[model samples]
Target chain A: MAKKKSESSVSTVPSPASSRAAGVAPSHTDLLRQMLLIRRFEERCAEAYALGKIGGFCHLYIGQEAVGVGAISALRADDYVISSYRDHGQALARGIPPRTIMAELFGRVDGCSKGKGGSMHLFDRNINFLGGHGIVGGHIPLATGVGFAIKYRGGDQVCLCFFGEAAVNNGAFHEALNMAALWKLPVIYLIENNRYGMGTALERASAINDIAERACSYDMPNEVVDGQDVLAVRDAVLRATQRARGEHTPTLLEVRTYRFMGHSMSDAASGTYRTKEELEEYMKRDPIIVLRTTMEKNGEWSDTAMTALDEELKAVAQDAWDFADASAEPAVEALTEDVYVW
Target chain B: MPVVTYRDALNQALQEEMQRDDRVFLMGEEVGVYQGAYKVSKGLLQEFGEMRVVDTPITELGFAGVGVGAAMVGLRPIIEFMTWNFALLAMDQVVNSAAKMLYMSGGQFNIPIVFRGPNGAALQLSAQHSQAWESWLAHIPGLKVVAPGTPYDAKGLLKSAVRDDNPVIVLEGEMLYNTKGEVPAEEYLIPIGKAALKREGEHCSIITHGKMILVALQAADQLTKEGIRVDVLDLLSLRPMDVEAITASVRKTNRAVVLEEGWEIGGIGAQVVDYIQRECFDDLDAPIVRVHQVDVPMPYAKNLERAAKPDVPKTIAAVKKVMYLDQ
Candidate 1:
């Protein structure tokens, strides 16, 4: 695989400049803020995990913040979002508040799922954020069904489905995509190609290198975006959303990015399958750094202002931690609640 | 009252429910153009159009999960497995996705979906295609499992399941589809978690569900000829079982027998026995006995298949054993 040395790729799809011309002016400052919020929140999550405040397979979204922010930034408020277990980034990107998410990770009653669901299963009916399903490739078909319901009721809403590159080899993914394309369901099948399915690399698991190209088998239109470039990610999603709303079509999007941290808190970032040199190579093109540099070149931002915003986001994360610390654990009687509805 | 086949009664339920609610739709491999494998959905595609009466490709897990997802967002999807045997491929979606979605999502989402098809042995279907699924699905916490032996209960209970706010599994007897029974002309729904007395007596209580209810009734007839009058209780639903009705009948008769179409090892009968021992222990006159399928995969030969499954003679034998008449 030819890794891009530059921090950002020049997208062949509509660029950020082209989007501005097309009357879809994206708020770059807000995008950067959202990405930074996720980054800071996850940094705190890592700290809490290390302190044993949070337990059970906590995955940090340190490097892959741009994909969640940019893609989610393109959707309407009514549009739905569903993803795999590594989902705190997507939940934050979907505008679920930091405090409620933190409370959920702490297993408190104030969490989004009322603490019934933990970190991997955050859900909010009000915002249309379906959930972060635990099983790999499990929620893809659920997203397809959301699209099916939308079309059935004669609505224009689109659902964004997220999973890892490793899930492409799973049967559920193929089954969902085939049905979505065949029925022209309005869903965006987004694969965050962070290169590894847990400990194993994609090349060792999947039969082919071009993950998006496999969309050809289902006859679905496909796109590959520079995952670190938030603007590039937004443009690809905007085009796909347009197709979804207008033609009731589904798109397969491959966002190639790198996971700066380990698969989860249990593993080390440097040892085993990935080397320190590889991590260093990817760090130079860090999404946060890339976006800040672009804003600086455009005369829209400065290093001092960026530092202030970073501190503000960190404070917000710190406040969430405080809120989570004081929140009460769920009542024992809640065990039998919500299991059935008549 | 009007006479109807069990298949036609199920079809009437689907048609009536689809007419009542726009959220109700049917999806499976042959539910649309093929009009259902057993013709349970005949004339539905023409009434509701292809979009509602959908024909999915041969992906059980995928389509089953899609039904759960649709149900999450407030669409009532009726996913018909070609048969209960084929549904094995989609058990993960049924059990993991549909069954747990409401509980896992903290009540944020409820899957109002039904998975129905011909279940149990259908004449020499061999080992792979002739298994009963009541015990397997009833064990799940957030799901409702119903198996009706009569056409009236078939139509009524199906309508009830369609309107339910949770996932339900409707296990229709494959052999009972062609059987005819009286059904009401007006709309009615048989509530789940209730048992119906198919036959009344005083000597003993013969408990059963699904197709075994028919064999139990037949045994009751034979026992009556032998001067042993028994009560035949058809357990309509398996999960929220009618414990009150069960204990009431056992208290009156002081003897009981359970007949099921599934295997004996930890089957639905075991749960019934547990409830009996706990609730009606002092009222019993003799030990309870269960009549079930033989502990082996279904055989191919006609004679072997007949011997493997419980018949009227086996049900009678079980009733007699519970009556303290070993002969």
Candidate 2:
């Protein structure tokens, strides 16, 4: 596996000089492919919700595809990842089978969490995706502890804890970061600053706009990146992860991003805090569109190949939906199982 | 038989358990370097090294979650809080993850972790440092709550807790750690959800556990001198409590006195008495009596603290009242 190091190098596409330096790649085709998969999957979830198929609190990871794919693309398969309730895109980007994720959403026996955890508690142990914790910032400390375990067991695994900008105000967020920095744990605290935390915009809640600067309080290095640009997000994570693995130093990455969807499937897009015009402006910087334009210019992608991958993804997503829909609910006796180590 | 202090028995139980199972390990504040707050885990670090007998930083939540995660995998982790009072910092991990993980995951994950430490009023340790949290833990369905009174029960129960596949909270009384008793030098397993009969009688059943067990035993001896045969039963586990033993004793004795060191209103003793009344209401010769500390903070002075806690005199009076001896 070490001999395939060169083959594992991150892909590239051309972008603006400023963007390129920050790690924005020109590979619009690949970026668009990932963004489309997430968008279509979430759209299907929204449809499922309307049809009364998926129950429990379902937090869709729609316009936040770039933060997950761009950042996750920089990580190795062995590295661990944990995220908050808005976790579907991250799980997908980390290579979890869509069928398992859909099954979890559908509350089927075949789900990643075996139907025990619906939308809020998605857990895929195989992909090293710890969970989709329902608590606001409950899993932050958990990620830091896992990082400590990785270091303690003498492993090169880095833990990426993805939380929202709203979590910056949480006591756990501060407490976990301080402890992580103090212990010099191999972790990257990725705050996907998507402006809104649930219903409230972050500006209305957080006293500090730049969460990356908060890392300074713990004497850790911080970086601010364009979350919309997959390449840029990847670059920031690559450097931070390298430092975490090499020097055993923790890094904080504040990815400035926006979520095009409401907090949940039920929430309307219209709101007092965000204007339609502002939403449109951010949509112009849609990660998929930016990547696609770059790929077209770089000649790394063609319309035919893009079309083929799009069809392939749609078919795969449909298969996932069918598999989840056809799967049976767990047995009634299973309700009392796994409570104790009997 | 070996004369062992309650503290040494607990240390031996932990040491023996660690040696017996590779997955069994201890994690706490001073459990490794300083031995333990009460020296209950002394000298095990040298034998097991840092891996098994881990000395963690004072981040209760962090270590507690780690214990939960480790238990979720294959390891059986024994989490020692400096005192059960400090476990409040990790209550979410215990209550939410360790206790409810099985039910919430639809029975996919069973947490085989033990959260053990001294619990309840310990001298003048102050209000913040001393508490009886067994009732709070017992309220949860999945957690097994145990509080042992004697050296034998403590060693046997602690070993059982370590071996149990479910999360168990073993509440060791701080004052009872030094109390000495004869412990058998052989492997023994104490099944959870079982009660122990400390003394045999027929007049009135005295149901109690932990520190109050001593009080009940003393009260039985005193009552025997007065021609009152008081049956004493030590409740080892609070959850999945021995309802059968309690109800059967209450039926046989025809009267009862429930004793506990916690506040009188919502104590484990109250639960025992309630269960007896609910299960065997027709068998009562007299109304049930609850002997507990007055509803007040444990005082600092030794006399005041003793006055606030249930003692042999209080237990004797409660037994007499329940058996109609005064009548």
> What total of clashing residue pairs does each candidate reach?
0, 9
lDDT of 1 by residue, A40-145 (tens): 8898898998898887878778899999889988888778999888999999888777888999898888888888888888898978899989889989999999
Best by TM-score: 1
Give me the displacement of residue B219 in model 2, in angstroms: 2.0
Candidate-wise lDDT, in order: 0.89, 0.81
Cand. 2 TM to true fold: 0.88
Per-candidate RMSD vs. true structure? 5.7, 6.3
DockQ of predictions, in order shown: 0.79, 0.38
Query: What is the fnat of candidate 1?
Result: 0.75
Per-residue lDDT of B54-118 in model 2, one digit per residue for the tens? Answer: 77777787678767756754578899998888889888788877887666555556778899998
Model 1 lDDT, residue A130, Cα: 94
